[model samples]
Structure formats: structure tokens, C-alpha cells
Target: MQRIIVIAASAGSLDPLKQIVSALPVPCSASVFIVLHVGPNQAVLPALLGVLTDLAVVHAEDDTPIEQGHVYVAPPGWHMRLETGRIRLDQGPKVNHVRPAADPLFISAAETYRERVVGIVLSGYGDDGTDGLLAIHESGGLALVQDLDEAKVPGMPYAALYGDHPDAFLTAEKIGERVAALCG
Candidate 1:
């Protein structure tokens, strides 16, 4: 089965994400899903990420096909969930005070994909993605997190690293390289 990568981040995440995305090989075997905390009115993340990487990045829409080699970013103020090979955007209650929280996306993918999911936590101000990472780990999926020293804001990565379940601990660039190798 192809990989399903769900990444969650918040404050001070853009640069790390750019490196990670730019390093991922073109024609990857994973369909990447990203959640970033942005206000309801801000919608430029996908385009910004698009300019930094070779992958085709788009704001996820309801019922959209989750195709390999493409990057789908949750729209501001909505959560994106994986439903088999498709995506469903939900206006569900926010987690950790953020609508597009990583927990929902990570848990959805972990539940549906089981061992095929890769849950990643990056730079952020809080512990939003930690529970999601736990779900992936409990389901036998790989949980990867950035090293705290490498993160602009270390709270999210630190939370994941504070636990024993994360499969690997590395820098953002290294994580991207490792992901490319896994999905190649």
C-alpha cells in the first residue's frame, strides 16, 4: 500500500515545512496531508507551499480524491480527514483551540490506513499533534517528529518526543529525506 502522510504544525512552521516539501521527491508514493493553524480568512498557505516545492499543492476540498504525489493542505478554519482514498473537509469542533488541528487529520488517517500511515509533528507552539501521533503509534503506524533543537518553536515536537512511541527523531530536512526514501 502507498503511504499516507499527515503532518501537523502551528507557529514558526513555514520554513521547516518548506524544506521538507522541497526535499520530498517528485513522483512520491505518498499522498501528503498538512494542517496548519491559520485564521478563517487566510487562504494562501497552499500557494505559498506550492512555490517552495515541486509537488502540486492545493487547498483540500470536500470529497476530493486523495491522489499520490500531490499535497493537500487543509483550508483555514476547517479540518481535513482521510476517508479511504478521498478527503473530507469538516467544520467539526476545534481541537486545542484550532479548527484545522492535526489531531483530527492524524487520527482519521491512522484509523483508516492503520500501518500505512505516517504521522509527523513539526514546529508549533503547543501540543496539538501529540494525541494524533499517539493514535498512529497505537495503530502500528510510524510516528516521526522533528528534534526540538531544530524547531523554531519546539512545543509540538517536544510533546511527541516527550513520549516513547515516536519511531524516529530527526531534523526537518532529514525527515524529508527519510520520507522520500520510504515513499520512493
Candidate 2:
């Protein structure tokens, strides 16, 4: 079965995101989705991350077929969700007070993919991705987080620990390594 990896990040996350993306294997085994808090016009993340990895990195478009070895990023101002073997982009109400919040993507992936999902919460502010990581954990999916000591902003990771323990607390690079190994 193909695996789905959902990642959430906010403030002080760019370097970690770069490290994680750079560490993945060229032909990654799972389909990766990322939701980074950005404004409606700040849609250049795909290009930024694309330069770090061999995998195709593109903005999530509604109804795009899920493809392994690719990384789909939530477009600015859109919530990205997974449905079976496809991706859905929604411009619905803001979650966590952010349009392209991680909760919706993480929750939908947990609900749709169940045990085949891997939810990762990286360096960020506030608790946007916490509940979603809990959903993934309750659904029997692997829930992981960046080590608090390593996070530039520890709020998100700390909140995740408070709600439910993650499978591991690792550096961004280690997280990528584990993700590759699991998907492999």
C-alpha cells in the first residue's frame, strides 16, 4: 500500500523544511503533502522547495491524482486535503485562523488513509497542527514531531506533546531519514 506523509509548519520553519526536503531520497517512496502558513499572494514555496529535492514539488490543485515520489504543497490561501487517491484544494473558512492551515490536511489524511498515514509537525508557532496530529495518532498512523530543542519555534511541537505523544522526537534531518525508511 502506498503511504501518505503530511507535514505542517509555520514561523521559523524554512530552514528545517529545507533540511527535510534535501534529505529525502530522490525517488521517495511516499506521496508528501505540506501545509505551510503563507498569505494568498505568497505562493512561491513550491519553487523554493523544488530546488532542494529531486521529487516534483508543486502547489496542490483540486482533484489532482495522488502520485508517489511527488510533494504537493498547499497553495497560498487554500486548504489541501487528501481523498482516497486524489488531492482536494479548498478555499473554505480559515482553520487555526489561517487559510492554508495544517489541521484540515492532517485530519483529512488521517481519516482517509488511516494506518497508511504519517503526520509530522515541525517548527512553528501556536497549535495549529496539534489536533490534527492527534487525529492521526488515534487513527493508528505514525505521528512525529521535531525535537523541541531543535525547533526554532517550539510552540507547535510542544503542543503536540501535550495532546498526545509522538512516535519520535527528532531533528528535521532524522525525521526525513525515518520517513524515507518507513516509506521504503
Candidate 3:
């Protein structure tokens, strides 16, 4: 089974992102990590996201063990990295103009998990997830991007599809189905 991570929307994203996450199948075998661009000063995101999904949703904690069936959100203003089955929280420099950028998370997962990883790029602005998705593809892991027409802001998905050919280009609903399949 593969570990699946989702790098979703930032501005104008709360509703769609929540809908997608909430639609994930229960008792999933993949550990779902999310990088949703947000301001550094915002309050608790895990609590907010938890309200939308039945899965255990929480902010990434330093050295926390990554487990299946849990959803981890990168804390505001920090980059989240995966290391030997554990989460490594870093105050790393922002990439693509966003702290906790999707690039680092996707890159780290590709490096650590290799072919046992699945990367998904959802709706958002800028090319944050493009480089990381490329890394995932290079590592022989599956890469998915939300279809441009289905994205609220298609820049991120468009950049990903053009920058690196993903394995799947799908809508949020289809993304959920594919993720569940990958986890099976």
C-alpha cells in the first residue's frame, strides 16, 4: 500500500478542500498529509479541518509518528517533512511565496517513500506543488492533479499538468476514488 498526501488550495479554498477531504473513504490505509496555504497568524487548522472529516485530523507535530487513517495538516508558517515514518516540522524558508509550501512536503515524501507514495495536487494559485509532483513522478510514485475545469483556481493544477505530466488528471470526486484505490 502507498502513503497518500494531498496538497490542496489556499485562498478561496476552504469549502472545496473540505469537501474533498471529507469525501475520503474511512479506515484508509494511506496517511493523508495536507498543505493548505494559510496565513502565519491564523488559529488552529486541525480543529477546523477535523470538523469536516470523520478521520483524525491534526497539525503536524515535531517527530510525530505518521500513521495510516490519520490526516495531518502542516502548521501555519512551517514546512512539514517526512523522515523514516515520522513527521519533521521545520521553520524552513517559504517556497513559491508560501510558508508550508506543497513542494517540500511532496519532495520529502517522494524521497522517503519512493514508489510507495501517492501525491495529489488540488486547486490553488501559483506553482507550489509542481516541482514536488515532478519529484514524485521521477520516483515512480503516482502523481495526480485536479482537472483544470474542476479547480476553483486552476493555476496550480495547470502548472502541475504542464510542468510534469501527472498519472491522473481528475476532479475532486474522482480524486477521492483514486486515492481510495491507491490505499487499498
Candidate 4:
């Protein structure tokens, strides 16, 4: 069980990510933060996803307080970080050639929340979240990866499995169920 959940995905990941979010059970006490690959002008994601999930979905803003049962999507061009119950967005240099890399977000959340964090890596083209998931593991947090066969782009999950070796491999819906179970 964890108080914070961070999800990272890219390249053919939108559908799975959306499913994961929409399937998340209620009484969800943990706050969800997402890092998805998008262009600088890609601002419609939060709204688009909001329609699919019961939880409030909004684009993340700098220095915004983190809340339970809400999903925060990292805005384009900024790296999002978790800071003691709040969020901080910065224009940091890109990692893995992506501006809003998952490593920074996962690492920051793990560093701040320690064992009270869960980091999940989903479908994506390249290896972006491996280091971050490793950081989460080192911090005693839960690390999960989507099943390689199920992912639209298996590269990211495979990398996480081989490079970081997460605690579980699951489908998006199963992952959501697991998250809900953690609250029990």
C-alpha cells in the first residue's frame, strides 16, 4: 500500500493509460501523478481523459497541492516533481531525450515518499523509466510494469523488467485493481 502513485508511459500508451485511470476503484486515497510523452502544445490530454474516469483529472500546475483521489497529468515542456504533499513543475533538461521524463518524477516521488510510493511503467518506445523505477525500488517503494505482451509498445515494460525488475507485471485494469486493493 502506498500514498502516492506515479505512472510513466509513451508511444502507443494512451489507451492503456486511460483504461488504467478509468478503472481505478473508488475510495482511492492515494494521489495519482502521470508523465506521458506529448508535444509542448499537447494540452487537451487531461480533459480528454477526464471524461473517462470518475476521479478528477486535470493538467498539473506548478506548486499545486497534491490531493487524494485526483489524477494529475504533467504538462508539456516541464518536469513534474512531488514535494511534501505538493507538486512542482520545472523546465529541467530532458532525460532520455524527452522533456518531461519519468525518471525525474519517479525519483522525486520516491525520494520524498520513500516506501509510501508506487511507480508503474507502461507502454512506450524507449527506456525512460528504468532508472526511476530503480530509484523507487531502492527507496523501498513498489515498482510495477505492464505485461510485455499486453503493452502497445513493449519496449518500456521490457526494459523495466530486464533493467529494473519491478514487483509485478500486469494489465492496466489489474494494475488499477491492485492500486484499489492497496487502500484496503
* Model 2: lDDT of residue 141: 98
TM-scores, one per candidate: 0.96, 0.97, 0.92, 0.95
Best by lDDT: 2
lDDT on C-alpha atoms for all candidate structures: 0.88, 0.91, 0.82, 0.88
Q: Model 4 over residues 1-184: C-alpha lDDT tens digits? A: 3489899989978888877787776667889899998968788888888888778899899988898889899999889999997899999788899978899999999999999999999999889999999999999999999988889899899889888768999998888788777653
Compose the digit string of candidate 3's lDDT tens values, residues 1-184.
6576656566556666676677777777889888888869774778877887678998889998888889999888988888878999888777899988989889989999988878888878899889999999999898988888878888888899888999989877787777767665
Q: Candidates sorted by lDDT, descending order?
A: 2, 1, 4, 3
Clashes of each: 0, 0, 0, 0
Report how far off residue 174 is in candidate 2 (Å). Answer: 0.9
Order candidates by TM-score, high to low: 2, 1, 4, 3
Error of 1 at 144 (Å): 0.8
Q: Listing every candidate in turn, what is its Cα RMSD in Å to the true structure after a full C-alpha superposition?
A: 1.1, 0.9, 1.6, 1.4
What lDDT score goes with residue 123 in model 1? 91
lDDT by residue (tens digit), candidate 1, 80-181 = 888988899989898988999999999899999999999899999888889889999999999999888888899999888775469988898888898888
TM-score of 1: 0.96
Runs off by more than 4 Å, candidate 3: none
Global CA lDDT computed for model 3: 0.82
Task: State in Å the error of residue 127, model 3.
Answer: 0.4
**Residue pairs that clash (backbone atoms under 3 angstroms), model 4:** none
Q: Return the top candidate by TM-score.
A: 2
